[model samples]
Target: MQRRYVVVIVALLIVAGAGGLLVTGVCRVRELAARMNCMSHLKQWAFALHNSADTFPVERNEKQVSAFLSGTIPNADLPPEQRLSWLVSALPYMEQSHVFLQIDSTRGAGDPRNQRPIENRFEHLICPSSGEYDRSSRTWKSAGPLTHYVGVAGVGADAAALPLGHPKAGVFGYDRRTAIPNDIPDGTSNTLLLIETSQNPGHWAFGGPATVRGLVPESAPYLGDDRPFGGWHGNHTVWSSKKSHYCIVALADGAVHSLTNATAPEILEALATVAGKESLPANW
Candidate 1:
């Protein structure tokens, strides 16, 4: 009986160890999958932006584009959540044609035509590695208007009127250096475009102008901001390894690559300017 009891205890211990390993493996695999999916989501949006730029002239007036499109410039007139919210616009390209049709561009938020919830609860928007998605409520409150990706505007507010001046104004759109055509002699891959942003509620630190109305001041600390208990998982923050190491950027050549972060301040500054090619470091 004593021998049998000892054997049972040993077996239990082995079972527990195996279970622990299995759980650990599963978590790691899930995390990797989430990151890959996020990258894929970014690629889809990048292609969409490329297509939009192709349709619109690079040097065209920003206000004119907004007026022609009815105040829905992806990066210009539109707010952050709605600005880079190309998940609706790029639906067809990403094998989600049905969702795109649901968005009534003419109707504002409270319109009767806005029947289907504007927020997309699709698993694609939710990063499996992070807890941005509220599974119970089926909403994404971190960044406004139900989104997974974030935009990077190079030019500030005053510079939006200048050609390719403000790349950091809205989500997804880059400055002239990164957004314009490659043959134009003004472009760089190291400059930021759209990065994966954390969806923080109330204080949207990373959201662009569109989400400006709902965002808290950047002075707010991340401590009590109770979304989850982890560091930033996306490329926007300094904490992100993927972004600081090799950020995936869409280039002027209409190509995308994971670029090295070992870039000079001048290089980064040049990339921020619309006429970066004229001023950027030759070696960059």
Candidate 2:
């Protein structure tokens, strides 16, 4: 009788251990799927950028083609704050032309006429790994469904003030930089285009934090905390296993790289510029 009881107890322990392992394996698979889905989203945006460069009219209204692909749609007479995001301009190429047409170009991105389009929840602009922000109520989300992704405003803006204009070495700026293909002194494959961040304005239809962000020192990724795009500033545990060990980014060449949290700050800077003329480390 004693031997039988021992055998039964051992079998139960084995079953419990196996069940735990199965659950863990299932969870990891889901995380990976979500991560890959997020990568696909960034890739689509990259294609949109490329398509816009080659197709947008050279003279849309007044400014030259460079001006249209310019990061902001600011009228010469308007303040930078009132400018529309380049994201709006790229909508047509991204298969969201219907939404793009809804926007009134004569008005600012925040105008009442643009509200209907601003509320659109673009699934391709979101990452499954950013589920913590997905929980926010529609009304509370204000601008629209949150875009966990944001443009890399360049590595130099890693200063105290947010430089939204000139000298933004990245691919974008406030109507100051051009998105023409191969325009950068640094090759497309060598430059950073976008990054996964939570330290943004959470909106996608406007400029500034809504569309771009400087890779400032405070915005380290995966370190956890609201240190910019590094990790969730709010509750990190919003979803099961959401803390990622690496930060994901898309290069101008439309390639994705999973940068580990321990990646040196200098390495990131090297990748952020278009004309910095910096060389990356071999081990990086």
Candidate 3:
């Protein structure tokens, strides 16, 4: 009788352990699926950007095309700074056909016609791995999420002058591999174009921290706490694991990799410069 009781106890313990393992495995699989989806989202975006460049009109006369559309044209009625966001242009190619139709590019950005609620199809803005942010304050969070991706704004306003009249100047567009594909005098690949980032504007707002400066005319809504793209946070979690690490960026080359907090600041700077890729340190 004693032997039978001991045997039953052992079997029950074994079953419980296996059950725990099974639950953990299922969670990991879900996490991995989400990350893969985010990666696919970025890869598709990069391709769309390339296509836009191939199709958009190109004119050599600086300040001819709307400066909002081309970095090469500067100090015009509409500065290159006023250009439509690359994300907005990518709607159709992203399988967001409905969204593309809703946006009215002909109207001014501030026009009420441009605003679309998340239910209207903007939920696609978020990434599974990135969490939401607190709008009342600029900070990291896990609620009220917005997007799981972000856009690269070039190095700074100073660098903007270099590609001043080129169609792809304000950003590290696909042509970053080459100068506006023959327009700009000098351009280089391995130069950072689009990078994977959490859409939390609080941390990574276009200009900088909100405390340091006020919001820009174009980015006020995004900076709102209700939106998730308020901070500059990144993701760093092990494959098949539930725990998350800091920011990890997806490169224009379709490479999804980690960018640790320990990464050198110069490495990011080097990746941003149109010419910096040529002089990359051998160690990197």
Which candidate should be chosen as best, given lDDT against the real structure?
A: 2
Question: Model-by-model lDDT, in order?
Answer: 0.42, 0.66, 0.42
Alpha-carbon runs more than 4 Å astray in model 3? 1-19, 57-84, 95-98, 116-119, 122-124, 131-145, 156-189, 199-250, 253-263, 277-284
Ten-residue stretch with the least lDDT total in model 2: 158-167
Which residue runs of candidate 2 sit more than 4 Å off their true CA positions?
1-5, 57-68, 76-81, 132-143, 156-168, 179-182, 218-225, 230-244
lDDT of 2 by residue, 1-284 (tens): 99999999999999998997777677667677777777788888887877777675354345555312555676775554566777888889888889898998778877899888878877777666666435345223334556777777676553112232233367776655544443466667877787887555466777666777667654454234455554522222332555545567888887987665677776777777666778787777
Residue 275, model 3: lDDT of 39
RMSD values for the candidates in order, in angstroms, are: 8.3, 5.4, 9.1
Cα error of candidate 1 at position 195, Å: 0.8
Q: Can you give the lDDT of residue 185 in candidate 1? A: 36
Reference-based TM-score, model 3: 0.56
User: Could you give the candidate ranking by lDDT, starting with the highest?
Assistant: 2, 3, 1
lDDT of 3 by residue, 1-284 (tens): 99999999999999987887777677667656665665566566666656655556455445222111222212233333343344555566667767667766554233466555112323334455554432347444543323455544344433434443442232433122232434322242444444544333321111122101111223323221232222233332433443333343444444555444444454555554443333566654
Please say which candidate is ahead in lDDT: 1 or 2.
Answer: 2
Best by TM-score: 2
